[model samples]
Target: MNTVDALVQLSFQVQRILAEAGAEHDLSIVQLRLLGILRDRQPGMLELGQHLGLDKSSITGLVSRAEKRGLVERSPSPHDGRGVLVALTPAGRRLVEVGEAQINRRITELTKRLNATQRKQFTQLASVLVNT
Candidate 1:
């Protein structure tokens, strides 16, 4: 019907798909996002917060939880002594690889449900929404 309603429905569907797929990886969406961000290298807490649009407090809490689960670790930054670095462990990297595969599978399933024209339109609409 309306734009908001359509968006709400899409969000619900996306969340449901992600939740179902991500359950096997045992990661929250936020944690998954962080892993995606860290796929290449480690980042400091401030950089992570900025990238995630979260505050220092939120990042600290996430890092704390992740550390407790042995998913991540905090180390002294090679660039700066005062800054701390966040890096994924071997188990964390394995989890991320599995999660990425699962998430991609779910996304492919969602896309397959759309016709080519509808998929194109959805892509354009999503790009516009993100830019706005």
Candidate 2:
């Protein structure tokens, strides 16, 4: 297979793993992404929307649903009174941790076809692509 084709197939395989892991916790891929983003930084709605590639209304709806599920909360931004930041709740953090473990396990399984050296090289190459 060509490099593009191989990369596309690998993307699908990884996405499938992520979907399966997120499904175990009743999260859609987008929701999982939201929680994952919140696991580190608390961003205002505008920034969050940009990160998620969502518009204002769409982001609002997503946040609302997560809030209802006790997974995320909105707080007044310390820097901007008019702006609200979305953050992961304790429940959200716990869910992200569990879901991450499952995803890691599944992804490790997928990489088992590679030898240890190949796996290390692949990780380095993939990181370059991601970071670039």
Candidate 3:
């Protein structure tokens, strides 16, 4: 495969690994992503939609579902009285922790064949790609 094809295939492979990890925790990939993003900071619905590249309705539905599952909660934004912020609940944090551990293990297993230098190079390249 060419470089682009190889990168695409690698992307799919990584996504599969993440999907499997998310499945174990009963989360869709988007839901897992939401949890991951919420891990750092709570953001208003509009901001969350922007960060997730989702529309307002989609963000509303996603947050609603997560809230129903007790994984997340929506609160009145202190800075914006009319706006709501979405944040992970304590249960959500625990789930994310476990899900992350599973993803790390799966990724390690996938890359186990790579030598130390190759792994380092791969990490650097991935970082560059992500940053760009």
Model 2 Cα lDDT, one tens digit per residue, 65-103: 999999999999999879999999999999989998888
What tens-digit string does per-residue lDDT give for candidate 1 at 1-132? 998998899899888877776666677878777888888889999999998989999999988998998888899998998999999988888888888788788887878989999989989989998998
lDDT of 3: 0.93
Model 2: runs farther than 4 Å from truth?
none
In order of appearance, the predictions have TM-scores of 0.80, 0.95, 0.93
lDDT accuracy of residue 56 in candidate 3:
95
Candidate 3 local Cα displacement, residue 106, angstroms:
0.2
- CA shift at 76, candidate 3, in angstroms? 1.6
Q: Rank the models by TM-score, top first.
A: 2, 3, 1
Looking at model 2, residue 74 earns an lDDT score of 93
Q: After superposition, how far is residue 29 of candidate 2 from its true place, in Å?
A: 0.5
Model 3: which residue pairs collide? Answer: none
